[model samples]
Target: MQPWTDRTTPRPALAALLTDVVPANRRTLILGPHAPQLIESVLAHSSDVTILVRSVSDAQQLGEDFGPCLQVIAGALDGLQTPPYDVIIASDGLDRLLGYDSADLSWTARLDAVAALATPDAVVVLGLENEFSLLNLLDSRPPHERHGDDEWRPLHDDPTRPVSVDQFRTALPWQAEVYADFASRTYVRADVASAARPGELPTRLATAAVDQTDVPLLSPAHEGLDTAARAGLLASVPTGWLAIIGAQPTHDIYTESAHTVLTATQTPTGWHLTTTPATTSDTSDTASDTTGAAGELLVFDPGVVPSTISSGVSVESVLFRLAAAEDVPGFRKLAADLGDWVTDSRVVLRWDDVVYDGESFSHGVSGWVAQETVAKEDLLAAAWARFHGRLIGQHRRHPWPPWMVGDDLVSAWLGMSGVEAPEPTPATSPDTLPVASEQVAKGKQIAQTLDDLLGITNELADLRTVLAEAEAAKHELFEMKGHVYGLERTLGFRNKAMKTRENRIRELRGQLQKMTAAHDRIRDSRTYAVSRVIFHAAQVRKPKVVARKLVRKFRKR
Candidate 1:
């Protein structure tokens, strides 16, 4: 790997633009064919770096192990537990990402899959061959004649025939759009130059062009630069452009191999960009002002704005709209439940006159009335009696008069009953004695003869006493209830009258105060007006009299 240096004048300018654009210490993901020299140049300037490389063997050979990153998929992205990576470089990885039949991944599906793996704020850059470029046209030669690693190298071995750029363009519009939308800076093929200067050409092509191989490029973030001499001018750029340095003979525009570099600059409107040649091998620093600072570029891509456009329409709104358009029975029922209905007097009048009178009065007047109305009334009375029986059934289920077993029958009839668990019975006391005498024996015999009779007599007496007590209690309760009702009515009436009186008093007091204040104001105004008038009249008389007296005195003198 080589550090970035300026061998040509334009090289320094290009280096400066890149340096200004790339962020210092930020990681950049690079994709596509090898550009090791370019990688060296970028690393020389950037402060910190990480790289994701596709050439697993090369990664392993460099003593770098992927651990579980490439393999253990818990689901699709299982092995990602490897430390968080900063940059991912895929040289010739797009075909794989797009699911070349070998791997069977579609571009759209792969894009979606990778997006799920990436940070929401992560910057994603895709680089593809500019199918429209002049070099891409030249690289379509037969396999043996073409560059050893040409895109279709494995397909054909014909040494003489070459495929034109136009033929390739016909098959690849999908790849074009992918590159355009994602690439911040797209590289069009540039003519190859000889040395480190402008417009110079190499004298001759090597006899074994296939044998002459370029250095295997470092990963996209380019952390392999150790020396300054091999560093390309393109490497002078600062980090964060996600530099896509594509300079493969497979795309063949140059007699000598050189690459193109794209550096994206962030702007409020969109990404501003700088593109540069990736071939200069000069290591000495020419212009400090031209190169970007170590830490200046932004690594995160904010992605598309409004998100709706890039992601397409949302399903939630469409579903909601469809639901709104549907006249669901659920909504109808809800509306009915919420609505209010009122039966009017007009409806009652119509029912009574039209249905009731018309059926009865049309027949012989008295007979019709007697037969239709009276019979209907009798029928209604029978129905009412049946309805009242249900009320009686309620009473039977739970007798109304309270029972002594601690049960409230009225509450039971009302269905407001509750059960109280019985208390445990106390053990019978043992300390007791029995007494007997001649009189006791006579009493026992008397009780034996009168047992059932005494019970009947006692029951009758109890019933009478209960009835009388109940009547007296009812009368007392009625009187008390009446007293309470009268008290409530009297209190309510007094409260209302008192409030009215208080309001009237307040109004009268307000009026009296206003009248007194007005009377005082009127008296003061009248007195002041009269005083002013008298004073003015006195002044006028004095002025006239004084003038006449002065004149008379002067005449006498």
Candidate 2:
């Protein structure tokens, strides 16, 4: 197989646009490389179709697919000469039509050559990729197409190439209608005024295109799209413009929803959109105010559900908006109503899953059912519980104090959601932590999720250290307690000895006092006084002195 270049891949939305624009049973010419699906779509309407390709292998493959119906020419556009046909399609811009053998042609020269191939009344279709596209700015990968091996002369280097939507329209020879193409082709096919109306279909479709882009961007494309919409510039942010020369396309905007591509045609009463059944769905579908009435956008299959033109702002978007604005009262009022709605409806837990245009609340496009039966109260609690983590983690600003976070904040959110929040468990540090505990959702995206897992791993490691420290501290405390008990026993024995010594000293003092009183009474008696005076007169005698000494010794005893 030849390496495909400048191939028009089958886009269902783009196909619908092609079918509506291209007429039946006409002579057609498709230049450069186009996907088999696109060729088949062209053949479905054309009588005699000719496909011109620079790849010889592709030409051979086409010959086999359509033996006689398709006339395949395998050469550069400059080499092959062709008569004018009723319709001409060059989906890939002028650059891809040039081959190795052909001389380098300016964009102006190439346009002139393509014009020469068409008849006076020929309907021409062309695709011009805008240089200032978000994809071009966001794409971080190395060269694949823009300045790759195939593109000898890069489209950017060409001074004559059209840059903007207006420039692209002016570049076309005929008065062509230009459309801003994204994930779905032909989202903005009407005047700027009509597309830029209150309906958010263009913004949603554009942002959906951003989400579907398969490349890493500088920043989140969703955020960028939202910024663009708010600035009133979404109508002109084109990845590429599909310009049609002869035929004016019938429809205004073609957008895709849950399972189907919907055509939004404005009517007298209001706009008509498709709807799906109110069942539990998994993926969250992005919605617009123009959705078949704020929350009532989804339907089973092809059916035009009429919706009035009103401010059908999604409750989810509104809540987020309120949170961003730090409007606690506004957020509370809406969140309470949302909780009530979720409680009543066949529940999809996300706030974004429901829509409210101020008057009533209904289901938005995307939905899913719970795996096991869950109470509506639990659904409301768990969703906000999850959102609570996102609020703090995403650094969402709120009027609540800094201390009120995590579970405390979750309780507050649940209260606002109109559910009586469960009372908080009082805080206490556990003596020991288990090696592992079940982990619930933390509202972390991929990068932060990796960090969170790393953080958990680090905490687990830290927990091991903590356990070791605690074990050591416990042993030390046990030893200290034993030492204190021993000290108390020793103090008791010392106290008992001191009390015994005090009692003996008190008894000895009482005996001394009684002896002193008896001696005083004897000295005061009259007979004792006379004997004392006689003993004093005979004090010189040795025998009396000896007796006196004996008496004194007896009294001391």
Candidate 3:
């Protein structure tokens, strides 16, 4: 029995790749769970095909759906006893090929087993999911896929398996074409090599891929993908890699967009570029289809022979880099050039879609045209307006003040672009010219904003904590000052009391000195002696009376 009944994941890029690699009437083997549309596409290419799915129920549905045209095996890879196939399609990878009764096999072991069932000269298109894909790294959800061992047994830490593109190339000594398969798009090496030589079609497709996704990504995928592209790691960091063994690659780069599976070609045909569609049935239209409605998207400009190469890095990407780096002067110069490019004719263009080499602006590979006539000044304002929203909304730092709102910055940018600035709009709606509404409100952009806000909230909480501490210290200081004032008053009162007591003691000492001087003068005088003698005679006549009188006199004194 299988772990899950239906484990099919739809990959349009992989499917588009299949249509190119899988030709007509070739014995092909699809040896894992894949989208039904992909399987049908393979079957349509070749009637002699074998599909091995682990789920019995899925196999039953497939058998009922396709009838006897396909050989559907509802069993493990080890159990299947079929001859080697010419073309083996395992774009779904081999991890899902595990079952209850199957032995614990490493990634390389399974690949070896699958390789054993392929002929020496067979074309094997195998997929390897990148654990380090930007989307995978930016996901904020729980990693149940890593821990869900009960359902699918993942081979962990297999040194024999390739973890990166270089390692994969090293592992496969044969000629193999590797594609960086994001779900919506895939880039070929030639297209990704050099924008000046081939073109920046890969980056253009990457930007489209970023815009089309509606998932809850942690940050803007465009920024990450752009940065990856600049760092020369875009192909190395896709959702997965498709290694086509024993055959050459098909095109420069192709994207399975919402509209069609478009392919870009860079042939020097009188300097006009052209791009073709992968398959007539799968693609809605070719990239070079110029017959689009007046206001609708165009596949590509039919004039450029190599739609993949461009003048230089996109004007839009450079402008964003300038803004992000806080390079206002550089941004203003570039903006002026962009403004010059957007006369009345090119007013509906987006900067991200255009590349500015060093000097001038080129009508880039953006597929849209202005629905109605737009003013030159209004287009400049619209461009700056979009930048303003993304700048502040994404919490990106700028040379301008944080208090400055969108209208302020937008007006400033317009002035820098040498255009007549408009009246300031106070409200901060996330809308920009092309994607203005999504500047603040888009799920991916808002998720980045949310992640930044969470960090800001923590910072604000820390500030509040410091303020609380300061308030407590302020209370302590106030109490200390009051205590000091009370001590000063008490000391003043004690000093005043001590001065009064000192004055009283000095007066008593002065009186004691004068009395002693008077007594001394009386003793020195003769009259004093006569009076003393008379008192002595009276005391002698009545000694007891005299003594009593003397005692009374002493008591009175």
The order of the candidates by TM-score, greatest first, is 3, 2, 1
lDDT of 2 by residue, 209-322 (tens): 555555545444555566666766564565777788888876666654543455555555334454332111211232222233323312222232234333254454576678
lDDT of 3 by residue, 1-557 (tens): 73357555455556666777776788999988877768877988885988998888889988998899888888888787788899999887777786778887888778878888889889898878777777777654556644354336464666777767887766764568787766545555522532322125576666556444444455556567767777777776677777888876566566654334556555652112334433433343322332342214122322332244444666656766777798987878777766666776423345554555676556554433343455566656655555555565445656778666755556666666676643435556655342323222322332233223212122222223356667979998999899999998998998888898899889998999999999999998998999999887866866888889999999999
* Models ranked on lDDT: 3, 2, 1
Q: Give candidate 2 regions above 4 Å deviation.
A: 1-8, 141-156, 184-186, 190-199, 257-259, 267-270, 274-311, 342-358, 361-414, 422-557
Q: Which candidate is the best by lDDT?
A: 3
Top of the candidates by TM-score: 3
Per-residue lDDT of 389 in model 1: 30
On the 0 to 100 scale, the lDDT of residue 91 in model 2 is 68
lDDT of 3: 0.63
> What's the CA error at residue 527 for candidate 2, in Å?
60
Worst 10 residues of 2 by lDDT: 435-444
Q: What is the lDDT of residue 87 in candidate 3?
A: 92
The model with the greater TM-score, 1 or 3, is 3
Report, for every candidate in turn, its global Cα lDDT versus the true structure: 0.29, 0.61, 0.63
Point out where model 1 deviates above 4 Å.
1-21, 27-33, 41-48, 60-93, 96-102, 138-140, 143-557
